[model samples]
Target: MEKFRIPAMRYRGLVEALQAEEIDFIDEAKEFYPLELVPSLEMTPYPHQSEALVAWKLAGRQGVVVLPTAAGKTYLAQMAIQSTPRTTLIVVPTLDLMHQWYAHLVAAFPDAEVGLLGGGSRDQTPILVATYDSAAIHAEALGNKYALLIFDECHHLPTDFNRVIAEYAIAPYRLGLSATPERTDGKHADLNILIGREVYRKRAEDLAGKALAEHEIVQIKVKLSQLERERYNQLIQTRNDFLKQNRISLGSLQGWQMFVQMSARSQAGRRAMLAHREAKEIALGTDGKLRILVDLLAEHFPARILIFTADNATVYRISQELLIPAITHQTPVKERHEILTKFKEGKYNTLVASNVLNEGVDVPAASIAIILSGTGSTREYIQRLGRVLRKGNVENKQAILYEVIAEDTTEERTSARRRGDNSPQEEKHKSGKLKVIYGTGKKQDLKAAEQLEINYSTQNKDVTNGVTDSSPKRRRNHPQET
Candidate 1:
C-alpha cells in the first residue's frame, strides 16, 4: 500500500508560518500550573532556557523543546512535570530511552511512579514513559489515561500509524523534545500542528564553553589501505561516471542508496563497493580513536562504552571480530537484557552496535561512545553523542565520542547536508562534477589518524537532583575490583 501523506490544509498552514517567519500552534491546556509556577526546581539556567520556559508558558505551555542534545532537554521536561503535577505520559523513541527517562523522572520526583510501556509496560504510576510504537498502537487500551503528554525525540512522530496517539488522546498539555526540529525530507509541518515549532534552539558552537557542555568535533580523514585503494579508484570512477552520465544530484531520489546498491550487484560492482566500504573500514580500523579507547578503558576500566554504526553488516562484522556483545533487531529480548545488564554491571568494557542505540537508551556517562559510521542526520549524530553524556559518579564525566570516516570518497562528500548550510557533497562530487565547497564553515573528514584519538571528552562529575558529586574528580582504580 502507498504511504499516506500529511494533511494538506494543516501542512500548508505551517508552511505559511515558515514562509512568513512566525510560530503558531494549538494551545496546551494548562490548569494545575500557570505561567508563574511552571519551573519545578532551581538550577541556574542560561538566558535561552529562561526565555524558553517563558515562551512555553506564553504559548499555553504546550509543544516541543528543540534544544541541542547536551542542552539539558530532560531538565525542561522535569520542570514541566513538576509544575503540571498531574498524571503524565512521557512518550519516547525507544525502550532504551524509555528506561533513561524513567530514571531521570524517578530521581527528580522520587515519590512519583514513573511507569514504563515498552520492551515491557510496567504498573501504572502517576508518571509514565512509553515508546512511540506503544503510545500509537495501544493508546486505546490506555484509554485517555494521561493529563499531559511529553514526546521525547518527537520529530519522528509523523508516521500515520504513530499519530494515532494524538488522534485518540485528549491530553491538553503537550511537550515535544528533540535536538532539532528539521526533517531530512522537509516534512516537519506535521509536527508543527501536532506539537509546536522551534520554541528554542542553540548551536554547538553557540553553547561551547558557556551555557552548554564544552564540545569539540575533530574530524579525521582515513585513507584506504593499499589493497583497498586499488579497488577504490575504480569504484570512485564508476560513481563519477554514473552521476556524470545521468546528470543528477548524488543525494536526490535515492541517489546515495542507489549508488551504493549498484556498486554491490556483481563482481565489478562488489569490487567498487568494497573499495568504498573498505575505505571507511580502514579509516575506523587505523584511526587513533581505537587506541584512545584502550587508553580510556585502561584509565576507567569500569566505564560503559556504546559504539554506534550506520551499517548493520559492519556491526555484525565488528561484534564477530572483536568478540564484543552486539545488539540488533534480531537480538532477542532476554539476550539484549543480559548483554545490557552485563554492560551496566561493568562486566563488559565495550559494546559494538548500530543505529538501535542512538536515540533511546540510558548509556552511562563514565563510558565513551564511538561512531564507526553514519550519514548526515544531525539529530541522530547528536543523540548518539547524548547517550554517553550522562553525569557520572567518581569517574562519571568521561563522556567521549570518536567518529571514523573513509577518505576521498562519498565519505568525504557527506558533510554538505547540515541544517541550513550546504553539506560538503553540495559542492564536491555533485551531479558528476568535482568541486570543493567554498564555505564559511569548516570541512570535517575522518581519518585513521593515531590508532584512536578520542574525538570528545567530558568530566561528567556534576549532577543536579541525584547522581554524581557537585564537583569533578579523577578516581584511581582498584586491582581487586573487576
Candidate 2:
C-alpha cells in the first residue's frame, strides 16, 4: 500500500534483493548483467579513507595509497571502484588473501558480480579478483575490458612482479596499496612512479590506542629448567674456561665482537653457540610457550587467538601436541575454510598459522596474538598484532602480543627487532659483518616494504609533497609495467 522514493544512485538492500534471487542473479550476472552495479561489502568510508578517495579522484589517474593494514585500506579500493566504474582488475598476493579480498569486495558491492581469476576462475564479474601471477599472465585477455587497476600488495611490484602490472589491460586508472612507502634498494624514487609514493599514509601508532583498541606488547622470557640449566652451565663453562685460558674477555669491543667473529671463524664456536641456544629454547621458548598458553587460557579463557610462527614444522608439531589443528598452504581449501569458520565462530578457542595466513584475512574473533618466531620485521610484527585489534567483543579490553625469544643467542639479540630508523645513540654496525635483516618496525606493525617502481607507460606521478599521480591517458606500454 505504501511506495517510498528510493535513491537510484544509492539503493539500500540492493545486495540483499539480488542475493535472495540467487538463480536469477547468477543468470543475470552471467548473461547480460545491468550496467548499474552494486557491491556487497557494507561500509561508509572513514574520514581518512574518504581523504584517500579524494586524492585518487583528484590525481585523475594512477597511484598508490599507503595506509596501515587495519585502517581500512581495503575499503579504500572499494570506494575507488565505485568512484571509477570501469572493468576493474584487482591483484593480490596469496590464495588466502585472495579469499579475504573476495569476501571484502563482495560485502562492499552486493549488486555487482565478482570473478576469481587465479587458480579458480569462477565468476568473471566486471570486478575481477586474481593473484598477482594470474593477473600478469592473463593481462592480455583482460586488456581491452580493464580500465581501472588496483594492486593490493604494491611493494611486491619489483623485478619479477612488474610484469603483471605492465601488461594490465592498459587500465587508465591504477591504485597501489601498502603500509610503508620505504625501499631497501634505492627504489623509493622508482616506486614514486611505480605506485604513486606516500599518497596517504596513516601510521599504526595513530590508530592503535583509539580507532583501534589499546594494546600491551609483552615479551615472555622462558628460562631454562633445572636439568637444562645444568647442561647450559656446562657448555658455558667449557666456553668460558677456554676463552679464559686464551685470555679472551667477552666484555670489551675486541672481545665482544670477537665472540660473534669467532662464531663465524671457528666451527667449535658455532657449535658451542648452537648447543647453548638449543638448551635455551628447550628451557625457555618451547616450554614457556606451552606454559604461557595455559596461563593465557586461564585469564583470557574462551577468547579467540592467533598463534604465529616462522617454523612450519614446529607449528604443525606444536599444534598437534596442543591438539589444535594447524593451518598451512598445504591445507585443503574446504578444510582451511572450515578451520577459519570454526575459529571465527568461536568453536575453536585458538588457531595456529604460518607466515602465509599472516598477511591477509579478517579474524575479527582473534583478540590475542602469540608470536613464536619472526625475521625481525617490525612491519610483520605489528601486522600480526593488528589481526586482533580489529573491532570486536565488549569484554576484549585490549590487544595482547606475546613474543617468545630464546635468550643468549642471535635469536635473543634480535628478538626485540629494531624497527624504523630510530635507534638510541650506540655502537657501529658494519654492513657486511653479518646478514642484516631489518624489521619493518613493531611486531604488530611490520616495517614498510623496500621500494620498487611502478613502470607505467605514461608520465610519472609526483611524490615531493608525499603524493603522486599518473595522468589518465593512453601511452605506449613500458616493458616494465604489468
Candidate 3:
C-alpha cells in the first residue's frame, strides 16, 4: 500500500486504525528519547497518590487526576515521570508554577537534564517545564519533541489557544492534574479529548485529616448599618424594578446574559446595572465586616493569616487599615515575590490579596483565612480554603476559614450557592464541612470595641510596606473606621 502522512495529533489514532486493518507501515514522527532516570531522594507515596498512579498506568498513562490542592499533585506528577521514564514536557499555567516544576524536577532527577521554557528562558533539555503561553506559541516545533506530556492545572488546557498545544503534540502518554477541573464556561469538556478521561479523583473533604489538615468552615453574618441598609434596599429595588419591567431573571445564565446585552443599549438598562453593582458593593464591603475583621485579627494575633477580597479596592483598604502586605494583579513581580517570601519566613504574619493568590501561586501555610468578599464560585472558595489547609509545623493544626457575609442582602444567597445550598433562609445549615455562625458580625458593645487592639508584627518594615510601625508594641483603642 502507498504511504501517507497524518497530523501530529492523529498519529496515535491513525496507527491504531491501520493496525486494526492489518496495514503495515514504518512511521517517523516521534523525536523524543528515553532517559535513564533515578530520583536522588527517597520518598514514600501517600495512599491516594499511589492509587492515582496505578489508575493512570492502567489507563495507558493518559488521563486526568483530580486531587485537591495541598494533596501533593506535583509529587504525583514526579512519580508518573519516573514510572514512564520518557522525554517529558510538563506544562503549567503560570511562570511561578513553571519555575516551581523546573526546580522540583531538577532536584528530583539530578542526572537527567531538566530545563525551563518560559519567562524568557528557553533551554532545549530532555525534560522541559513550560508555561501554556510558551508551549502553545511553539506547538509546531515542539509537536514531536516529547514522548510524554504532563499538564499541571490541566483545567486551563481547554482554551481555544491552549488546546492546540495538546492537539499538535505527538506524545502518546499524557497526564493532567488539577484541584478543580470544572470551568464556568464549560470548556472543561474538551479536556476529555485533549488529554484523556479522568482516571482518578479525590476531593478536599475526602482527603481531610489524612493527606491534608483537618479544617473547619465558619460563616459569619454581619449586619449593615441602618443608613447603609436603607441605601442598599433602595439600590436593589431600583435594579429589581428594571428587571421586572424587562422580564429579566438573574437566576438563569441566559437571563443574566440577556440583561448584560440589554444593559449596553439604553439608559434605563445602564442605570439598572449601576444600581445592581452599587448594591453589591454596599453588601460586600460593609463597615461591620471590617469591624469583625479587626476583632479576628486581634484574636488570632501572630498566627499566619490570609485575607481575601473580591476587588482590589477592598484589598488595598484592608491592607492599609490592618498594616498587612497586599498582593494584586497590579503588584510588581519583584515586590510580590518579596512579600510572599517574607510571609513564608514568618517575618510578615498576615497577607491581604485579591484573587491573585487563588490559583497557580504557591502560598505558605496559614492557620486562618478571612474572606472579606468573594463571588459565588465553589472553585474560588475551594482554592481559598486550600490556602490554609496545608499541614503545618504545629501538631493537630486546625485551619479555620472565616466567610464574613453581609446579612439580609444578596451576599447571603451567594454564600449559600457557593456552599452548594440554594436556600439562604436556613440560618443554621451544616453541609459536610461548612458550619454557619448566626449574627456573629453584630457590633460589639462600646467598651468591648474600645478595648479591641491589634498587635502587629514587631518587624515593622516587613509588612507595613515602608510605613514605620510607630506603635508596633500594641495598637490600643483603635477606633472602628468606615
Candidate 4:
C-alpha cells in the first residue's frame, strides 16, 4: 500500500521474512531495460559449461560458480547474460580485469552499449562493468541500476568494504565466480549471505585433460650457500628468541598481527622483525634457487615460462639477472599491458612477476611456471598453479609448475603449509603418477637430475596416444651445472 526502500544487499532475506509473515508485496525495484539484439556466440560452450549454466539456473539464477582459470568462466558469464537478457553489472577486482570484462561484454553484445565505471570511464549503459573499488564507492548510487549482478573473482566479495557493494546492490539475480572460493580469513562463509551458495564446482584436476591442461607439480629443494645459511640461522635465532621471550605465537591470524604490532613497539622487537625479514629474504632469494632457475630455464628452453616471486624486489632481481621482463604493482599500466601483450604474442618466452599476476590479469598460457617463493596461503599457491595450467597448443602437452624452495630453512615449512592436503602432488602421488625431481647439487643427486631431464625431453612422446608420460629421464653428469 505504501512504497519504501530497503538496502538491496538484504533483498533475499527481507523477501523471505515478508513471505513468512504472509504479507503481500510487489517488487518494483527491478526496472525493465530495453534489450538489444546481440550477435551469436563466436564459440560453442563445452559440455561442462552447459552443465554449469543449467546448475546456476536451477539454483534460481544466483550462486557462485567455481571453475578453474582458462576454463572460460567469462564465456559462461556471457551465456548467463544471454539467458537472463537484463540490465547487468559486472564487478571485478582490478582495473585490468575491469577492462577485460568491458571488452568481452562489448564483443558479446555488440548492439548493446557497454559501459565502464573504472579506469577513469563513467559510462552507464545497460551492460556495465565496474572495478570493486569503484563499485564500493558508488554502491548506493548503483543500488537499483541493474537487475543482475555478476561478481568476477567473487571470492573478494566477502571483505568488509567490498561486501558493501553487494549489500547495496538491488540485483535480484546474482552470480559469483572464482577458481578458489575459500578465503584465508575464513570470510568465504559470508558468501552464502552476500551472494549465494556455490551451485557448480570444478577443480584443476577435475577438468584436467578435458577442460584444463594436463599438469604436474614438481617441488625442488635446494640448499643455501654455506655463508647464506649462517646468516639465515642467525636471523632466525634472533626472531625466535624475541618470540619466545615475548610469549608470542603466530599460529593464528590474529597472533601474527599481534606479533607485527608488538614488533613495531620496541627496539628488540624491531631488530627481531628486521632479522625475520632478512632471514626470509636469504632463504627465498638464495643464489641456489637462482642457479636452479637457470638450470630449469635451460632445460625448458624456448617454452613459455612465468616466474613468480614473493616480493617486487625479488621479481626485479630475477628480471635483471635473467634479462626477462618483470611486472609488479609499481609497473606503469601501459608498460604492464605491453609486457603481457608481448608475452601472449610469443615475443617474450618468459616473464617474471611478483603478486600482480596471481589473479585478475589474464596471463598467457605458459608451458612452465617457476615459483621462486610465496606465502603460506593456499589461495596464493593455487592461483600460481592455475597460471600455467591452461591448455597448451599441443595435445597431451603437460603444464609443469616447479616450486623451488630453500632447503633447511623456513621456506620448507612455507612450501608445505601452502600445499596443504589438496596439493596436486598429493593427488598425483595417490594415483602413483607423481613426477618429482630433487636437485641438491650433490654427487649422488646427479641421477635424479638426469631422470628429470629425460622426463622433460620425453613429455611429447606419448602425445598421439592421449596417454600421460611417466617414464623417468636418464641422469645427467654434473646436472646442477646445466
Q: Pick by lDDT: which candidate is best?
A: 3
Candidate 2, 132-221: lDDT as tens digits: 878777755665455567888776665455554643333446788877545445454565554444445565555655445666667665
Candidates sorted by TM-score, best first: 3, 4, 2, 1
lDDT of 4 by residue, 99-194 (tens): 788788777777888899987888878888998999999988888778678999898889888998888876667889998889887899999877
* Clash pairs detected, candidate 3: none
**What Cα-based lDDT does every candidate model obtain?**
0.58, 0.60, 0.80, 0.76
lDDT by residue (1-482, candidate 1, tens digit) is: 88444332233233334324433333222111111123334577666565555555444446566766666778777766654555688888777778778777767766555678878665666677888898787866653566567888887787777777765655545778777667777767787667655455555445444443344343445566676667656656765665565453566758767766765666655655555565455544543444444554566555566777776776776677567789887788789888878887778878877777765565554246767567777777777766665553433143456555666656554543432336442221111222222111233222321112111112222111110111111112101110
Cα RMSD for candidate 3? 18.5
Candidate 3 lDDT tens digits, 256-334? 8999998998999999999999999999899999999999999999899999999999999988887889999999999
Q: What is the TM-score of candidate 1? A: 0.66
Candidate order by decreasing lDDT: 3, 4, 2, 1
Question: Stretches of candidate 2 above 4 Å error?
Answer: 1-35, 38-42, 122-125, 167-169, 180-189, 226-286, 393-397, 421-482
Taking all chains together, each candidate's TM-score versus the true structure is 0.66, 0.68, 0.86, 0.83
